[model samples]
Target: MATVELRFSAQPEHVRTARLVAAAVARRAGVDEAVLDEVRLAVGEACSRAVGLHRSHGIDAPVHVVLTEEEKLFSIEVGDEVPGSGGGASAVPGVRASGADDGDDGAEDEMGLAVISGLVDDVEVTSGESGGVIRMSWPTTPATVLP
Candidate 1:
């Protein structure tokens, strides 16, 4: 497997840089053109979400992106530190709390999650020693085989 990692301040402008780097890595991994587009958009959305969370919480930390190319899959992980929380709080407006017990309502729209889910084959969200993580992966096609 080959991996590429990028780290930058959680600023709005930096989201575009993340997208570009993700696209370049996906392209180098032989991802399909259609899938490449999806990867770019997903990376942008993930980075944007992280940036918003950091800004809202007044946390000045870097957002980290890691792209890995394996024999059968291409994966991307976007992570950032969430302030005051153990990185488990939901930052996206419409996402349901990871493990909420509130009986009020589960009416959150989760459009961002929906979009990410639609684009990638698999997605996992978690809080870890590093921070909040959004990991997405797509299966590589036979055409994506390395020469």
Candidate 2:
């Protein structure tokens, strides 16, 4: 197994960098060529979600993106440092019951989650006081033996 870890300030612009890195790593890990765009989009959404949570909650902790490559799988984990972000409503961290506090609707968060679910076949979302993590994985093609 191999891993690549990245931490960046809670800034929206940095999400693009995370997505690019994820796609590059996924490609090298033998993820299907057609799935590269899905990986990029899912990573972008997850990173953006983390960045938004950090900003909204006044938490300066950097967003975390961990990419792991195993024999037949490639996984990426996006985490945020927002307290109580995962206690309830949705699987995603920022999600809340419709029309919750912060004077902001949770629709965007839900939409982001929906997009991620649509893109990734294997996904796990969890949160607690410590923070939250969205782990998404894709199957990797096995290396063919050349005679």
Candidate 3:
């Protein structure tokens, strides 16, 4: 397996950089064009959410995006520094709180977690020693053998 990691300030503009890097890595891993699009969007959403959460909590740490290429799958993890209080709510203008009973909150309307869940094969959110993380993975296309 190979891994590519990028770390940048938790700023909104950096989200685009994360998406581009994810697409480049997916392409390098022989991901299909259709799935490439999904990877791009999913990475963007994950990065945006992390950045938003960090900013909301007034955290000045950088966000980390890591892409891993394996034999049969490609995985991406976006993480942000843990807030001082151990938890922080998103205050980004368009992002909605992640919860089932939060009422619409426009989460479905916008490219939030809901959209990421649909675009990627697997999506997971968790908090760890470093911070909160959004993990996404997709199956890779089988390598074609030349006759």
Candidate 4:
């Protein structure tokens, strides 16, 4: 089994750490260089969304990243603190609302979750319920990247 774990702040600067961690994992998994870059980009976009949506109710929460390489696919799970610290009312992160699909200058310049969905074979978003996790995965098969 091949897996990598990383922890970083929810701040923007820390997103780079997440990206680096992802790239490292992909490389270690023997993923194609081109496919590796795509994974890194998708990881950054997803983690950034998670950071933006984390609840800021006086609780300092670090983003958690887990990359697991299965025989057929690579899975990435990014998790954040839930509302009320995984208790009381459920709070979902709002990063999807800030997607790059909006008709704005910033949106036009950056690739958002929509692009992420396009690049990967599978993408999933799950709000922390009693502290749940959001995960994304893609097939490692070379044909997945073919034109």
Indicate which candidate wins on TM-score: 2
Clashing pairs in 3: none
lDDT tens string, model 1, 1-147? 438999899778888899999999888777887888899989887787677667656678888899999887889998878632222334434444322369343332144556777877788877755567889887776553458
lDDT of 2 by residue, 1-147 (tens): 438999999998899999999999999889999999999999998887788777766788899999999869999998888765643235445444333477476666667778999988899988877898999999999866779
lDDT tens digits by residue: candidate 3, 8-118: 898778889889999998987878878888999888877777776676567788888989998888889888786321222332343343342656553532446778777
Model 4: per-residue Cα lDDT at residue 107: 36
Give the higher-lDDT candidate: 1 or 2: 2
The lowest-lDDT stretch of 10 consecutive residues in candidate 3 is 83-92
> Tell me, what's the RMSD of every candidate?
6.3, 3.9, 5.5, 7.1
Winner on TM-score between 2 and 3 is: 2
TM-score of 3: 0.77
Error of 2 at 61 (Å): 0.5
Comparison by lDDT, 2 against 4, better one? 2
Q: Where does candidate 3 stray beyond 4 Å?
A: 83-111, 143-147
Error of 1 at 65 (Å): 0.3
Model 4 spans with C-alpha error above 4 angstroms:
55-58, 83-111, 141-147
Sort by TM-score, best first: what order?
2, 3, 1, 4
Error of 1 at 108 (Å): 11
- Where is the poorest 10-residue window by lDDT in model 1? 83-92
